[model samples]
Target: MRADRLMTIMILLQNRGKMTAKELAEELEVSDRTILRDMDALSTAGIPVVSDRGKDGGWRLVDNFRSQLSGLTMDDLKSLFLFPSGKVLEDLGLHSGALDTRQKLLAAIPGTFRGEAEAIWERIHIDSSTWRASKENLDALKTVQQAVWESKKLTILYEQADGEQNERVVEPLGLVAKGDTWYLVAIRDSEFRNYRVSRIHKAIVENETFIRPANFILAGYWEQSKEEFIQRLPAYDVQVEIHPSVMKRLYFTSKFVQVIKKESSSPDQWIEATLRFNAEQEAVEYIVGFANKMKIIAPKDLKSKVVSLANSVIDFYNEL
Candidate 1:
């Protein structure tokens, strides 16, 4: 552990040129005495660590000192160019630094791999936002980001689906940006829950702090939650007879429906297919779009609803 601290101190001195013992201690979450000992260790190990004593004095690496990461290969250098989505970076207030960080990384690569590594940027770009997604109001984003970084608790006013407002004090863990939307994953009452960033009417960083769970990984936990949520959803199957021409339009018509099985009765004229929906009303609404091009084959109740809805539409159109 001390070896790691010594190496980290050396790297910091090399990059920062100069830093006070107190500053290093704060950055490493240690005491000033430990930092002084680490400095002595680095100097004893043949590193040129210069320490000054005065009003404007601190530790610094001797002039002409250069320490580069020798283990980096061409692929490693290229991977450094990979960055998160721009919207996410902007929310975290790192958009400006992202570009500067990439360029500085390019300058750090050895000449042998520099050209090939820089070519990655010229060839690749990542766009995570969906086309024409409405921009979310992220006024609370910066406050929530700071809380996550500082491991501070947050008292937030959240809007619920029933139009009721609830205030919760959550331990801010991580943020996930999908398309133009942001989801705040946090711990409340010792349970992990997700809150939409846009739905947060107010966010106040509390003075309290929370010990982050040692094994709670943001990416892994979010994925597991998604899988569990999907598994818990009730799925119903619908049997339908669809004309061959109408099947192509089914894909774009419903987001919740998908064909599970198909049987060809007349060898390409009509297809009997089983589709999945979350509810019976969903099935009825989707079936109504096809009109006479499709017919319900089973679930007599759903068929009756479709007929009733169709007749209602006919009556409404007749009055016009």
Candidate 2:
């Protein structure tokens, strides 16, 4: 571990030029004293580490010395070649560039590890889109991307989930791709918000540039926002008995349903399970789709609704 830390220190100093002991310690999750000790060790090993004092002082390598300590492990090589979805790259106009980069990386790595890296690309593949392949309209993505890159304000016509259109002027901060969908993280009316790129019907980049917030980190903000959004979702729980034959089907339909618990049963016997949905209507609709394969055990009102809906479907078909 100490050897790894020493190598990391050398790489950090080589790349960042100068970093204070406190900064290095915070980054490496160590103590300031530990960082100072590491610096002394590096100097003793004739690494040419020089430390200066005062407010603008830190540790740096002397005479523009570059270390040849950079190396990639097998896992690192695999991670570099684990490409994201091709459609996502095309959406960002990076598909061709990504292909070129992949070729260059294959040629640049050490020849000893080349065969394993090539095998990784051939054996493993990632498909991030849903099975249904819901198409998204991202015509405004290029404009939004440009605004984010230039730190420019934008005038946008955004359509809400309820089909209401509203025009707003926002300061573009960053773009995030969750699954196959893209969202623009921006500041509107001095508050941070995420706008679905598909819902952006129109976008006009403005000439005025806004100063980005110093404390805002794109990835950090997205993670916090995602967690908060999940916490705010409504939940409706239900108990049911599902036929053993359809057990695998239940697990496959997880986009709208979550299995909370399952009671043990014989292979041919019905399995008692608890499931959760976003609302009572959704639960009823989902349960009824399984036909006679599932039976609701609790919430008498939900069972009645499901029965009524199923009968209505039958009566309509009979009339037809």
Candidate 3:
């Protein structure tokens, strides 16, 4: 990167008190003339660096010259370290600032709980693969989250997969972020609709805000939605001859009906597990994900559907 040497110089100066031109050149593997030129550029940029001539001479940024980023508590800094921002701030080719900001951030925090913080940092990693990217709509997201907190009306443009876009005034209800994807559960036309943040092209905060009803919550609505789905979809009881050795693990998941039982002592380590799904298609799709691990026993339709899906996937990949 064009500024690689310059950044190196800045970091070194930030860490070490001061250094002579020769030291900078040797540390950065560059000639004295190159270092001198960089120092000129750096000085011109008002980098709070001073050079002394006679004996006690070297270039140095005024000690603690950089202002602290204030108000962030130790916990806050640690949290940021544990979960760095998703976006790449600058292209490495352009700015190439190394010394991960996260490391510097952690270093600045008080050392009292640094050990605990380190443990937490190692254990807790945010996949945020589902969090909406870009600051493009952050103000809107914050406004909507606030509205959800306050039960206020929000105007937003929602885009469908088919490329259709519609602008509507709706009430913000709650939010859920799955992986990096964020969803806003809101009331539209007296009905709850899940709006994917990425699909929302625009949001306008209305003059009106609201106080959210104490009775409302997104999770409660979601649980109700699951129950409703079960009622809506055709109920189909399924018994699968799952591999016996996995019975304990299968029971732990409880992905199936509570009515689980082993059919017989099998020569092969396998067990018969009974589960139920609202829709045959759903069950079929579910089992297909674990193709070799599961075998549908009683319901021929589920097995056939799984097989059909597998065949279709195989055919598609084979053609590719």
TM-score for each prediction? 0.71, 0.73, 0.44
Q: What order do you get sorting by TM-score, best first? A: 2, 1, 3
Ranking 2 against 3 by TM-score, winner: 2
lDDT of 2 by residue, 272-320 (tens): 9999999999998899889999999888678899989999999999999
Q: lDDT scores for all predictions?
A: 0.83, 0.87, 0.68
Clashing pairs in 1: none
Q: Which has the greatest lDDT?
A: 2
lDDT of 1: 0.83
Candidate 3 residues 124-238, lDDT tens each?
7655452344433443566566666665689998888798999998888777654445678878777778787777778877778755656886788877875886678666778
Shift of residue 224 alpha carbon in model 3, Å: 9.3
Q: Write the per-residue lDDT of candidate 1 for residues 84-112, one digit (tens) a residue.
A: 67766776777572125665565455546
Counted clashes in each candidate structure:
0, 0, 13
